[model samples]
Target: MSTPTGFMEYKRQLPVDRDPIERVKDWEEFHKLLSEDELRTQGARCMDCGTPYCHTGIDMTGGTSGCPVHNLIPEWNNLVYRGLWREALERLHKTNNFPEFTGRICPAPCEGSCTVGLIDQPVTIKSIEQAIVDKGFEEGWIVPTPPEKRTGKRVAVVGSGPAGLAAAAQLNKAGHSVTVFERSDRIGGLLMYGIPSMKLDKKIVQRRVDLLAAEGVEFVTNTEIGKDIPAKQLVDEYDAVVLCGGATKPREFNIEGSNLKGVHYAMDFLTGTIKSLLDSNLEDGNYISAKDKHVIVIGGGDTGSDCVATSLRHGCRSVTQFGTHQKAPLTRDPINNPWPQFPNVYTLDYAQEEAKAIFGEDPREFSIMTTKFVGDDEGNLKELHTVQIQRKVDENGRKSYEPIPGTERVFKADMALIAIGFDGPEQTLAQQLGLETDRRSNVKAKYGQYRTNVDKVFAAGDMRRGQSLVVWAINEGREAAREVDKYLMGSTVLV
Candidate 1:
């Protein structure tokens, strides 16, 4: 609370993003940094409330209320306001292992719960967080500071997503020898491929990975625990094993013509595009290109938006996204959706902004359901059929969508992408280890206690909790590391 009137004195501000039309020409990060003075002004807006719900990290009304990682928000904000960049970065790293990742991609549930947001826009927490870390890197203050001594205890971390990376970082910091196993050819699971480079540049992910590697975290790529090697091998070799394999099974629609040539899962398309771009800058022709094609993306989540943006970047003839739910209200409903809960409001995401720039209107069609895919004689997708839908809630509290009468429509689509989300972690590793799974097919492990049925093994992240935010994954990984440390050394210092 250095500036008692800061929240009222300064107005909320954010950096202007790269022009949508211009940024769509290449696969690069679109975000820009605010000036140091402007960022300080934004940081000053932090009310630093007594409760400080911004970092409470609570779940309310089936939505995240604050930062899942429980970052020291006010502390860092105050530090940044005082122009103590290094101190702010240090405080940020105290809780969040990778502020760069979360700052850029996270939806920032913390801002929704900010005390200042009750009256005006919330403090620019995400932007200030990013600037702090980016400044640290620029000043060469962030470097590989490996553990001073090793415990000689080897730990195996499965998966290399945010969760796995966070776990490995913490375990290494605890002086344990940690090895991360990633099935992909690369280190980052979702951050490297599942996300488009335009949102999260792969270089940023690799930069952190390089630092982790230098910090004595061994990384083993192109090897899977269950398939490439027996899951028991890690159990026998390592003192402890932590499973951070994310929920990777994408949900699919088994509708008619789903097996057509142009039909593909959203991850497959996104992964291929990113891989191709990274490998040869799209010269290899190894990915499914949307060049000069009519692209229809199903679902309305972030993944779907990425698909739309990717298609536009590939020079698609046209693009449209479908969502079963209606558009969100422009403003929050105070009664049903009160303060501190994630506001269900409408705003133009980056992808939609790009689509509108080119197509003259928003590319999403809400309250629509895909019925079937129609293909030509060559088995190539030509068009798709859909129907307008209305959501209905039964008296028992079950919700369903019903088709509207005489509202069927058809649209030309050279390619169709399914991005409805994911189910849970793949089942092979769990079955191999004889681990128990919950009804959701996620590994049966309690939240704080990440141990599975198998002895000397732990599960965390999407593998244990099902598909969720990357921030939640990081939180799970950190907590799981603490539990693993306790199980190994009989006491733990990890926070």
Candidate 2:
């Protein structure tokens, strides 16, 4: 701890945001960079707890927590505090393959479980972590460290999402020959298309993917197992197989008129737009654009928020979001979601704030559930029928819902986006492999082990655990790689 004396003296400081009102008008990251001096002060604020929960990456139940990738938080915090920037980055990279992605998009449970947060503000962990990774990129300290040796073992990673990439990175480091297969024309899966460039620039993903390629990771685009390439062929050619195809089965609404022309899945709109933007040959004109249209988004999750933001960019006449649950309190509710756990609370994201600033009110309508989609005779969605509902716990402690009286109403909607969530991984690959799946159709693999019933067939990320954050995918990838390595060598040193 280089600045222990300044621990209590220095307060937590996060990077300042650009003026929200102005920043929302464009597709760019709102958070500004903190100077080296500012970052040093923030790092110095870390109490660096004797029992640091931030880096444990495990919960009270002895399972994963805080950070899924299990980053060495204290070591990096200390390294940053001491101004040993390069060493600090090395420590950060020891566990995390892509701090840059997690740095920007991760919800940062590590901060929630932070020891300093018990009384005072958390030790600016997320901010400092972001600074460290970005600094490494800026200083060119981050490089392609290709393996000096290659193990003869061959591996095929299905799906080029975060998990597949992370697993490939680690396994390749261990000298195993690795190749990633992606059905999409371009690689990076969700990162390349699903996520908007405003939140995460696709070029940033491409940069990292390029570096991984230089380090000897082979990426095969437009190739999908059970389709373009047979599942049996991969199993025959490789010693091990990793499934990171991701949970692509979108959750559907049971409401009427869901099949209307103007109604679309959140991924369809977001992914379509990004693909067109990135690929000149691809035409996004076919995408569902809300320009001059009234937009209604179902669900209050990140995907719904993305819908709202994208609609605004498309120059929608008006935008509104419907959440089937009550609005959460702005402040943390320890009684509901306690400390050392992911605190449950309401937070204003960029999309909500953007809609609020533009529409003169928050776009969200909590406790409002869409009953049906009203559509024109031409099969185009025109409006949404919804009602407010109340939730109550039954005698069995199971909560249920009921619509409130006099709450039925109609909202104008030229376009509707369903963003409830994903259900499971698509069926093609799973069925082809004849792999066992849980009730949700997610590949059946215990969280830590990430091994499927089929020997040498491993699964990780959303494909195994259902939809989740990118950080968790990275964790699943690393852990699965460890298990795969062990299976091949009779023992492994991946962790």
The prediction achieving the highest lDDT against the true structure is 1
**CA lDDT, every prediction?**
0.94, 0.85
User: How much is the lDDT of residue 128 in candidate 1?
Assistant: 92
lDDT of 1 by residue, 282-393 (tens): 9999998999999999999999999999999999999999998799899988998898999989888999999999999999999999999999999999999999999999
Question: Per-prediction TM-score, please?
Answer: 0.99, 0.95
Using TM-score as the measure, the top candidate is: 1
Task: For residue 405, give model 1's deviation from the true position in Å.
Answer: 0.9
Clashing pairs in 2: 151-175
What would the per-residue lDDT of candidate 2 be over residues 1-495, giving only the tens digit for each residue?
A: 646655668777777777756876666677776888888788887776788888766644212358877888878887887889999999999989998888877878898888878877787778788889888988999899998998899999999999999999999988899999999988888878888777787778988999999999999998878988888889888999999999999987777888898888899999887777676533547566789999998989888998998898878999999898788888777666667876666877878988888888989999988889988889888888988999988989888889999989999989989999999999887788789999999999998899898878999999999998888889999999999999998888789
Clashing pairs for predicted structure model 1, backbone only: none
